[model samples]
Target: MQVELNSVWQVNGVDGLEKALYRVLQLYMKQRVVILFPLSDSKALLRPVKIDFDNFSEAIKVGNARPSRYDLPYYQLQYDDEISREHLTKRDEKYTLIVDLVSNPDFLLSFVERPRSKLVSLHAKTHNTYVQNIYRALNLYWKYAQERNALLPGYKNSGGRGKARVAGEIKRGSPIQLSSSSIEAPKGVNTSESDKELFIKAMKKFGLRGEEVKFSRVYDKMLKEYYAEELISAEAESREAKVPNYRAFIYWVKKLIPTDTLIRKQTNQGDFDRNKRGLRGAATDHTEGPGSCFELDATVLDVHIVSDFQRNHVLGRPTVYCVVDKESRMIVGLHVSLEYASWRAGRQALINSFTSKKEYCAQFDIEIEESEWPCSHIPLRLLCDRGEFICKDAENLAVPLIGHLSIAPPYRAELKGIVEHRFNILNEKLVHELPGTTKGKQYDRSVKDPRLDATFTLREITKLLIDEVLEHNSSIFQDLAKQSILLIESGLSPTPLNYWNQHVKAQRHALSKADEVHVRSRLLPTTKVTMTGKGIRLNDQMYFESDHPDFDAWKIIARNNGSWSLDALVDHDNSSLLYVRLEEEGSFIKCYLKKESANFANRHQADILFFKDWVKLEKNKAKPSAKSIERHNRKKQVIESAIEDTKLEPKVGSKSKRTKGMKARRREAILAQRLEESGAKPDQEYSSVNSEQSSQRIDDDRKKVISILKRKKVTDNET
Candidate 1:
């Protein structure tokens, strides 16, 4: 910003105006006199003015304010305080500038014609020649101010008197934004200082939060903070640093460090994964029609409820399972249990979702119109998170039952927003509001023993959740209805069942009785068990063909496999039953327990821990004394006699050859009985087995005859 005047220089017209402004630049660039008084005009106009801004103790007011119309003289001299006093006084000085009157003569009358003392007037009667000169003069100084403001250093480009912008033409409303961090890297800098500052700011906004958040959330915070900085300065030179060009830099940094990866590195995989999925899921269109897609997820219900078996023992928090239709947002199926969010909890929830409304409502004894909970059809696609959904057990159950199954990447609940939102509703709107509710956290549980206050048992909690889900599905909300653009267009109200009823396509896939049996069997947890001559040994307990009709076929499968080790499916929820593939029948047969362990309470809600505790309990059981054994047999005999005395004829729903029971039948006679028996018996002796008639078989033939003669029979006449 220096001008070397070797010898003397003179300019004629517009060029002379630029020269005069450049002289002011050279003086200010080398001297810090801005904080001082205005340059004094006691020094001649032809003489250059200089003052040391750092050390000056003098004042000089330099301008020709009083002038006569008769002499050719300058009115206002050049003034550039744009970044001057701000650097000096440390006040709210903005990088703005102003232009003073130049010696140009055309504009001299323009200022005069404005009614101010400038040697002329712009009245209606003023001469045409003077009026024309006024406009020309106004144009000339505007150009001069533009030239002067462009040449100052550290003068940031901005807008208005408020934003301190450069002298220039303006377009419509400002589309370009400005921020300080968007300032260009000063020349000779090796790294992206802007990017570094942005990283620290973004991390401060998001990563500093104790809990792990999603990349989208962090990116959003960064974008918000980025806009708050000073992007473009008021100097014409800095105008080229507009933020429109570098808008992508902040976002690119966020993408470089994915939030999901951060969570995986620093926190629980499940916690991070669930949140990541939720964040990732926000960028989607979930307005699907009913039965097209459904989302399933599990969360620990916020309330503490007692066990159904022991009301005094409070279960910390019951895990809740929900299956929600993407389109209708209906809670189609729900399961609330003490079980953790494993395959079994998700299993029961899936079954409830697909089961008939009549039967499901009967369990809770809730009466409502079938239309109130109409979502019974299986969805074409089933969506779930990575936790249980990624397991083979979950996949096997969902794939065949649903045509398409989607397990979103871990920790991403956003991918399954419908069910997650429903879970939030249950926590905030239902569980947390109830008595005995822990309201989350162990410290929260200590204020009062939820156990002492706990009135809701496991069964009651399930009922409460069921009632809540039912109400939510059937409740009408105008705001919710408006969310579906299609529904709004169609003039439909938003209730879960209503959204489903009006928009669901006719191609809904429903499970038949056979399909339910197939899917239910697949959902069972698989384990390897030894098939011995006695029976299948599981948990050191035996299962015999006599226990259930299914065990008979299951035994045959074991025989076909050389009567050794085989894979069997177990219902952890119902330890009383087991299933094995019947290749000839093209289905699975249900096996009942021949002998149950002492802990096997049929109605007791069971989780994986039940077996773990059972194992531990059995290990420490004391052996019975001789007198206790004798008394046990006597009690068993008395119970048997009582059963025989009070037994009623077992009702016969269908006819089968096994009804004869013992009847003094030979082993061959009983062995020949096979309703679905196909193919020749296996030639290999290991694969073949013959059964003996039971000495104590229940006489179904006598029962069947008596049931037909004197019972509630559906005869044609009665029908």
Candidate 2:
């Protein structure tokens, strides 16, 4: 090995490949790397090492082959120092020198001639003089080839090695002696121009990435066919018969095509685009404090949960929303719902996140101190997928939090590791243990119908989730972040709750009592309503009205004709009372149903539309238990009852005085219409006119009458 001549060079950034800005880094930094080490297909062992200044290798800086990234391969450079490992230079006795030849054009040209492989592969393949001469020529190519200016002026002396025709004496069928200065060229396979075209076309087709049969496989199949072999074999310019083969084709492909270009042809755009974008952000992105980054995500619960109001009403897979702190990886809040992943689901989760966990836990009979779940704070940023993250419900909640909301790329769940991992843990521990667990893709749990195995109601499972989350928050956690340059500054503790207790609680933004109440009231799922003199109507049948201070303010706004449209944030589980936003006072009014007295208190908890339909169906029944009604059967009964209620039984004999003479009037009108349609005008007809036109009109009217009577007679017969 030879080292480069000494030259003074100043160190600079790995050329502005900053990794901090893309991810949330309020408190910590982490980096992940994968490198294709030279001379090996395996990944390199990436680490910082002590190296002698004289032994340091100035890594080859090549122009980027990627069209999208015209800049240097900054990511690949992260592992450039791996080649400078001590063992790479040391042979036990002393350190060996590393060479740098990127600036030498002459060396690059010689390198292209495959000097290393030639030097390593020299062996006698055939007995004889010419073959031995070919070996000597290649041996000479391995050395003294880099001194191009002296030996290959005008690049002519390179011809001696290029054609291996030293002194132009080695020829076909010539029994030449093998000597140091006289050598023959290696045998070159010949192919017809037509076969060359066919080879190129096949290469183009095989270059594209896919799951289909590969180029080598196709070549093997083609070689087995007699007709294909005949088409490829042709007389070359040297009068030698030649054919296209897989090995020669592969060699050409590697010689002509760049690696990325070949990969791009084989795979789709998504593969390269993802690779170039880099899967995870640099560790610096999460250097901020705990409250700075909150990850929100929704996933279907593994276990089945039945409706709260109806025990046996299995709601299938309820969507579960989770909010977690990126810094601590602590689950801050969660919501389990009978609905799908909608804006409402996101709002429910946000409400839980901003509320006091002590009070929230008490609702489920779990005791916890405010200090235990002190994660309540407005995040500087909320990271989520496009699902509910971009919905209006999330937007409304974000307004108060004053945080930046980012949508993670669909494939990058690694960005939201905090919430995503929590969901994984929740399923592994809580949901999988339940009787009706789907247990993911294994199919064993779901094969027998998980719905049939469902034993927990929504309310019961909700309490279970509360208990699980509380346990998770209090449990000790371990930090498994990779060792990196970023980890040197701050030592992140393993326990999320302890870290929150020690530092994040003091630094996080806390919601005031008023702000908490406002957020709690605002984050409930909302439906549009109109503020009318009668009241606010929702779910088609329920009307909300009240004398609450908020309602009074709403009435004032409605009276002033302030646009007329209003929104009601209703509790999905309990539909009795609804909250209306009063922007006038920056407060909410709790409105009770106008017909609350007519329905059972339990009906208030049911979904308004479903409940109202049930109320009408069971209006006169002595027992109106929600559990007794199968959801489908209840819907069927409700629809049938509704139809019956809306049905009008026409009176027999003397319908109503209002409709008494309607039949006779209709009869007369029908007759006049028939006569007028037959070219008879009221203003000119119905008089005793003896004119010829009058007589023609009378005859036409008679014909129309006869036709209409015949049709009516047939209808009557059919009836």
**C-alpha RMSD between model 1 and the true structure:** 25.1
lDDT by residue for model 2 over 176-214, one digit each (tens)?
345765666344344444544555556565445442347
lDDT of each: 0.55, 0.55
Model 1, 304-363: lDDT tens digits are 776555576666777888898776678888777777887767888877677666555655
After superposition, the stretches of candidate 2 with alpha carbons farther than 4 Å from their true spots are 1-284, 391-397, 409-412, 442-446, 480-493, 505-514, 525-568, 573-586, 589-719
Native-to-model Cα distance after best TM-score fit, residue 652 in candidate 1, in Å: 65
TM-score of 1: 0.45
